[model samples]
Target: MTRYEFVARAHAEGYSPPKEVTFAPSTRSEPHTHDQLSFVYVVAGTFILNTDRAAPAYQPGETCLLDANVAHAEEAGPQGATILVARKSGRVAETG
Candidate 1:
């Protein structure tokens, strides 16, 4: 049988995996690193993203590309944020 999904777990697929991550009204994750990564669609309410200071503050529909090892932090804790991130397991070749 064929199934349809609006959201899936990241563990389902190693690469280009789909996951539904939910955040509370005020939640922020610890700063982390990914050698090569890209964030696809982010359905957010209200949040602030931190990057190398070059990237502008993200808002709804505002997409940004983050380089590897770039110190970054985000605070959606104030009002809460939900983002669906997608990344490649290996070094990033290209992102658009």
Candidate 2:
């Protein structure tokens, strides 16, 4: 469950908690799902994200928003990556 390391973590009043995570070069995460919505902001290096909808590569300053329960995987670039992520505490079930 812990594929990356958290360099920093903090919470703000009335806001979702934020974390800074770092992934080593060539590191990859197993397919996983989150119970809360995820907002990720790339800070340095590159990252490749594969989801049910698409497989896209992201660079520094790029951002990705993933809904809750969306199955996905991630891989760090050759130079590794550092990202800021905020996990909104909510189920946010998908509606059809």
Q: Go through the candidates in order and give each one's C-alpha lDDT.
A: 0.53, 0.73
- Candidate 1 structure quality by residue, lDDT tens digits, 1-96: 001221243335343664445567666567776675554344666555667564244555444445566667656655566666666554444455
Give the alpha carbon lDDT tens digit for every residue of 1-96 in model 2: 121322132243222656788999989899999887776778888988889789888888677777888899888999998887878755445456
In the predicted model 1, the residue pairs found to clash are: 27-77
Which 10 residues in a row give candidate 1 its minimum summed lDDT?
A: 1-10
Please list all clashing residue pairs in model 2, or write none if there are none.
none
* Per-candidate clashes, comma-separated: 1, 0
The candidate that wins on lDDT is 2
lDDT of 2: 0.73
Best of the candidates, TM-score = 2
